[model samples]
Target: MKNKTYVLVIIALITLSFSSMAQRVDRTNFKAGVHAGVPFGDISDLANFEIGLDLGYHWALSELIDAGLSTGFMNVFVNNDTVDFGSFVLEGDFPNIQYLPVAAALRIYPTYDFKLGADVGYAVGVNQGNSGGLYIRPMVGVNVGRSTEVNISYVKISDDYDFSMAALGILFLF
Candidate 1:
């Protein structure tokens, strides 16, 4: 009888501990960051680099998962290249390409401080004649304190022209 009672107490304690841990993580959070990107593929031929800012809000779905909304602005700087305008050759610096991306974000935590995340949505063009369309980003990050993280990600925007970049950033959580 004493052995059975001890086992039951141990089971109760374990259950309570799990419940407390779940409660601790089921909360809302906001994160913001800035990133610098290196262009790749065809984009590299036209754009030298990219810089961006991101903001997001997340609702904890479980201890290991979160769903959120994210929005950001990215600017791709044009390279100095000459474009043949058919009648003449146009040279000098071109206008920078800009995008405003809005996305649905999801994050999964495999460990306490490590996470994998993805965002999918649309990037709206800010410049006339610049077409923007689908936007996607996949990232991996490690949390460095209660409210800070460092991340590396790949971002893609597909439209009349497609662009891809590798980005590294820091995020602050609140």
Candidate 2:
């Protein structure tokens, strides 16, 4: 009976130690960045370029995966030369179109310094008569340091008018 009790206690101690070692620390982060976007396809005929800000909050789900929420503002400038009013050419630079994008973001880290990510969301137009639509962005990046990363991404928005852009950006994570 004494030998059996000692074995059971030793097993319990080993089980407890393994369970503790298997636990990982949870982490949360915030990231923000700015990007320059070049329009493509039919959008290139109307828009010259885009400038945007991105902000997000993410929580680590595992050693290699993160899930988050992201929101951002983007402005797409219209090409003045492309604007034709039939009777006369539109004179001034047209008002810049704006979008507010809200999305669910996911990222997977293949290496300590490399990651691939995607954001799926809706782009809401801030201007009257400007129809908002579905927004999708897929990106790849490398961490430059402990707190900064550089990324390149493609963004697509679909609505009454479909448009897409390619962007390069830098983000600070905290």
Candidate 3:
């Protein structure tokens, strides 16, 4: 919990600095943009799909360099098996194990509409059973419009328990 707070603070500070410097950039050459993406992944034996939404603030650090703060909620579902009270077996779906991830990533643009990035962040699970997990994802994104993008990544959490796929449907700058 404390770690999550600190990461958010750091991202906030960086964003503030970027916002202040954005006006000074050449308006025609560089611009900042906002993006939102939905990321999907698979959890181990628990759920078929793990999905999340990301909201990011991006700055064109350079033509080839970009940095941003990404925050989002991820839902991880699992199956729970319990025995019935002197009866047949009982099973049902349960609420998702949720996560809040705050991350910073560097994106490199290889072409006008293609981008690749690597991200590192702290994932704090919002469930009591799962305290939290830390993870890293390397992704590929394609710009579909001035305000939209799509991306995919492979993500893994520490302790080697879960490895999953992450797909993002994004809204962002051109």
Worst lDDT run of 10 residues, candidate 1, spans 20-29
Q: Model 3, stretches more than 4 Å misplaced?
A: 1-42, 80-94
Task: Give me the runs in candidate 1 sitting further than 4 Å from their true place.
Answer: 1-28, 83-92
lDDT of 2 at 129: 71
From the highest lDDT down, the ranking of the candidates is 1, 2, 3
Ranking by TM-score: 1, 2, 3
Q: State the local distance difference test value for candidate 3.
A: 0.62
* Residue-by-residue lDDT tens digits, candidate 3, 75-117: 7655564424344544675566677777877788787588888
* Candidate 1 per-residue C-alpha lDDT over 15-36 given as tens digits, one digit per residue, 9 for 90 to 100: 9877855784654388998999
lDDT: the better of candidates 1 and 2: 1
- lDDT by residue for model 2 over 28-94, one digit each (tens)? 3899999999988667767878999999998776667789999999999887764554565556656
Indicate the residue-level lDDT of 44 in model 3.
Answer: 43
Q: Please tell me which model should have the higher lDDT, number 2 or number 3.
A: 2
Model 3 lowest lDDT segment of ten: 27-36
TM match of model 3 to true structure:
0.65
Compare the candidates by lDDT and give the number of the best one.
1
